[model samples]
Target: MKLTIYFDGQFYAGLVEIETSDCYYAYRHLFGKEPKNEEVLYFVNHELLGLIENKSGSATRSSEVKQRPINPKRLQRLAAKESQKTSLSTKAELALKQSYEEKKKKKQMNKREFMEQQKTHKRQLKIMKRKAKHKGR
Candidate 1:
């Protein structure tokens, strides 16, 4: 399960298996961007090193691809600012979208439950009416 990855003229140690498949997928999905299998392996290896070994140095491809220094703090702040520059209703819009999805799911569940209850009620009623008819005969 261990793999050796090459980065910055060095090979870093990495693990293939994790407690969850999501971890594997997330690592692959992040670095799989048109990368060769070898590159993906290397990327994951170096990524793990950056994470466990160096917080500031842990950025995966930013170092190899960007060819320039990218401050993580500055990038995060820029992203937040861009999101805020949208209309004042952006938060409301996001909330409404989430609620709409929840409403749809809830409505579907209610419909299914209602139908099930109706079927059970009809079955019970039929059983009672049959019993009454048989007793009167």
Candidate 2:
């Protein structure tokens, strides 16, 4: 959703449904400050412009308030940066945890199997050392 601030003497009128809004700077007198992003100045008509101030209070004045849809990719990126923050999403986190557990399960071996693997590894190292020692001669 895009927002625009209205300017006076531009030969435009207010919207029943705002086709566009602008930054006329005249509404600051009513708002007592300059408008910020996502803020709006609506024309009651071409002659009268008023600022739509967002109240900090919890109660919404209108149910028609607009909101953008949540972006899954954006949430994933944020989740990657701060895992502990929760990102209000669990898909990536749970997927990572499941994969970690599965990997650990695959790598585990019985004590005897581990010992046999170590013995084979040592034998291979011994053969390599013997070959290297002979190469100099």
Candidate 3:
């Protein structure tokens, strides 16, 4: 298979025909040295950029990654996706806030409220403490 070699996705040194993906022949041909365990084809620094098709066989660039041109389509898609995600999160927070307000309104009890709720709260705390002790927590 033909692979376009790159250095940090920037320094493009054209393409070369290789017998296989991770073979010694390709590594030696591109890097001009035998491949190491760490600096293999798919590893850091030494990377097999991409495959060159017989029809569209052109991979030419030597600039750094930051200097490369951005695809407009990809940027537009990302912007739209981010906007949708932000909108959904905002809606969820609004719904949560509305529920919280409703609950707060319902819980606005008078001074002469039921003593049963206070009793039940004390009972629940006691039960929680007892369960914790029983479980050796």
| Model 1 lDDT per residue over 2-56, tens place | 4433332233323333222222211222332234777766666666655533333
What TM-score does candidate 2 get on C-alpha atoms? Answer: 0.21
Query: Per-residue lDDT tens digits of candidate 3, residues 2-83?
Result: 5455543323343454443332223312444444555554543344443322323333333321246779999999999988
**Which residues of candidate 2, in runs, are more than 4 Å off?**
1-109
TM-scores for every candidate against the unseen true structure:
0.34, 0.21, 0.19
| Clash pairs (backbone) in predicted model 3 | none
Candidate 3 residue-pair clash tally? 0
Clash pairs detected, candidate 2: 4-21, 4-22, 5-22, 5-23, 6-22, 6-23, 6-24
Worst 10 residues of 1 by lDDT: 20-29
Comparison by TM-score, 1 against 2, better one: 1
N/CA/C clash count, model 2: 7
